[model samples]
Target chain A: MSALAEILFGGLFQGSLYAMMAVGLALVWTTIGVFNFSHGVFMMLGAYIAWQLVELGLPAAVAFPIAVVVMAGVGWILQASVVRPLIGRPNIVLVVVITTLAAGSLIENGALTIWGPRSKQIPALIDGNTTIGGVGVSLHQIAIIVITPLILAALWMFLNRTRLGLALRAVAQNEDASHLVGLNVTALYGLAFAIAASLAGLAGIFMGGYRFMSPVMGSDPLLKALIVVVFGGISSISGPIFAAYLIGFFEAACSYYFGLYWTPALLFGVLILTLMVRPEGIFASRSRGLA
Target chain B: MNPILTVEGITAGYGRVTVLHDISLEAGRFGNVGLFGPNGHGKTTLLRAISGLLQAKSGRIQFDGQDISGLSARAIVGTGLIHVPQGNRLFPDLSIADCMALGAYSPRARPHEAENREKVVKLFPKLAERWRQRVRTLSGGERQMVSIGTALMSHPRLLILDEPTLGLAPKIKDELCASVMDISRGGVPLIVVEQDIEFLLELTQQLYLVNHGAVATEIKPGESLDHGEIMSMYFGH
Candidate 1:
């Protein structure tokens, strides 16, 4: 494959994964009215679970759904137990900090207990190289690229067209009014968290198959997702996706020309620039910050 | 005529500070009442308390004779007590049509969404004209219409409008008053909270003069309460 094609294909595949990963974080942030720091841990848990299941002789297809479902269940339970009790409280920062501390400790210790410190490779769902338009791409990478978009399309439909989707959107837009109209706001919060966790779970499995899984592998993806959310603007569904692809392509180009080590610097620079130019993210039209 | 909605001794407040103290009122079948008070005296808070947006420290709210005191905002709204809250709380990102659809968000109202939407559109032709337009892009008056139209979609037996004319022009306020009169005539009881005495007197037959969250006085239409009494009651001498 030509260098340019490699960059394009690599960027696209990675961007899709990044977008999916960050979407979960974004949903939790917007819907639950909390900056949950434990979101990345959920992703890690998914990867770890998928790795274990694959080790037990389960097929990749079965293992993936199982991981997502587990993570979603965890998400629901967490919201019910920890997040729900703190609703209407003014201590948002405390909740966020606690989530972060709890998540980091849990992930690091949980990984040590279950999967050990050693990194594990996931057998690729599809192997070998595939060529498209004179560009060579790995079949595994192509599968991820294809799957991510399809998942996103389904999510878009779920949020926009379904009954719960409308109610969820209403709750996100105006919490008090949604309650006034008789929506179960607490239930909506749980669903939002579950959806987010499921996305992270999906990302974890995808990452495990494409690369390698470790106890602390979630940090990079979580940070990248945060960047994508910031770049796309908070609360915008399409914004993060577009920004994800852009960042992915940018990272690939930087890695190719300047070496892989320079990618982080480039991403941080882009993030800083975005913050300077548009604090609300490139997609936010009006100020949505709570007064 | 049977009372469709009743508020009995509802002592409500924010947190520990009491705003409304032992206040009570009612809306009869096909009735319209004006709740008048000065700023910060619990006019809006009463509406909030009754609509289940704010929990009363002690009280009973009977909507269709069912106790709604401890009910969730959703349940209160489900019992045909819809509150068009202060400020035009339109879902700015959603279109006018979507906002209207969300009005009937309860399970019972969900099935008749299409029919209710048709009636709402007919009532507010301006909304029909801008059905697809996002609510955030709408003018103040247009957004108010969308807000009211959304409440109407729920097919509420009692509509609680809190300061609907807060920031509108005189002509727009007049138009809004006319809309309220129309809604009242259409058989939905209205409890309109307004500072404009003329606006209230022109449309409503009964008045609850709220002072410090308590019903200080009740005035019936055709009563010879002069403007002096109204001014003192509104301004709180």
Candidate 2:
């Protein structure tokens, strides 16, 4: 029972982090119709920037925010220069896919050149652990658990309570209608990309403290986020969060009972079965009301 | 009287396929103009050009005495020319209330959102009754009301409606046309592109007959020609 509890708690913390990452990807996907292959690279960039700032004697509080802001600026520039120009052009999807995949490669190689191949360790924001139900959890794990919900709550508020947020939703639904109704579709696209990148940055900062950072660390999280979004449904914001936890627990259970190697097989099996059975996803039957 | 909108020699199209050629028209303040033509001509294209959805290849569009040619659809909305596009392009998943609020998204309309919302609700009481329902759940005519109601939330000075009566029952169409007449009578200038000639004749002060991407003729209300005669002239027997 104690072992079971430990595994479940660990899964919950990891799942929350994946949820943060997946939610951002889902946002950009639903809004802009681009898969954003470079999403993970943004996360890597965030972690490295945060680490460099902390190394330069900046506090974790200031370092993380600066990283997030930098990621947002990167997002804006990427959208304006790369994505916006390709819009309404022939073969846009193919063009964007190639462009973003190339961007990911560039960012990954750039990080390797700058930071080298050695893994960087970031100090935890809060040190110590707490025990619950005969299982011990680190403060970093607790922070991951708490911070994800706070971010989601803030995101919900932004989408529901703000005009720009509503406009974003409008654009996601129908670009032509959004334009006809006086929405600056290009600006909304830029803003959505920025917001999505900022979320990735925040996730990276948290994960950097919780685990070792590497130039390629973002690839795993990126794959997990993609799986979560695919499993949850493309258009839903909350759906991916729910799917993230499910995948997390399943992976944890698989690793505990069988082995770490069996976890990937099970995850892929589930994804294949889901695609065969319900391509629209479990939660997609309900209209994506306001995400 | 100074016309609120003057479009002259405007040519526009979608990606090398020119749909409008030398299209010229004008609408005065508090006046309604109708564009009547067969499908696949230039009625919808011209409206798209005037609303700034499609760019003009040449010539000019002046709105409120300011040159507005080649401006973005978003900027044109700021000038108080709201377009309720065809197929009732309401965000199907959104509540009617949210849809209406989103219509007032332009900076110029933000201050008057609440008041304009009230006016729209009053204009289409059916929409008010189903304010919380998603737009997709509404009937075709009800969705039309929400579509126009959404446009009205922007407090448009010149309202352009495209095929508002499409796919609606005749009873509902009559009710919507009556509501539109009431709106036009309340002094909002209107440019309506529709296939219902009788409805256009009843609702519009003047009508322009379009063919082959150009305005071929202009006719006033109470013209000697009846609906059948106008139809024969426009569509041919």
Pick the lDDT winner. 2
Candidate 1: how many backbone clashes?
1
User: Which run of 10 residues does model 1 chain A get worst, by summed lDDT?
Assistant: A282-291
Candidate 2 regions with alpha-carbon error over 4 angstroms = A286-290, B221-224
Q: lDDT of all predictions, in order shown? A: 0.82, 0.85
Model 1 Cα lDDT, one tens digit per residue, A160-254: 88767877777778887777778889999999889988998788888887677788888888889889888888766777778889889998899
Per-residue accuracy of model 2 over B142-237 as CA lDDT, tens digit each: 999998988888888999999889989999999999999988987788999888888887888888889889988888655647866786887677
| TM-score: model 1 vs. ground truth | 0.94
Q: Is the docking of candidate 1 incorrect, acceptable, medium or high quality?
A: medium
Tens digit of per-residue lDDT, candidate 2, span A38-144: 88988888899999999999998898889899999888887887788988888887889899888889989999999999999777878899898898888888888
Residue A246 local lDDT, model 1: 87
**What is the DockQ score, from 0 to 1, of model 2?**
0.76
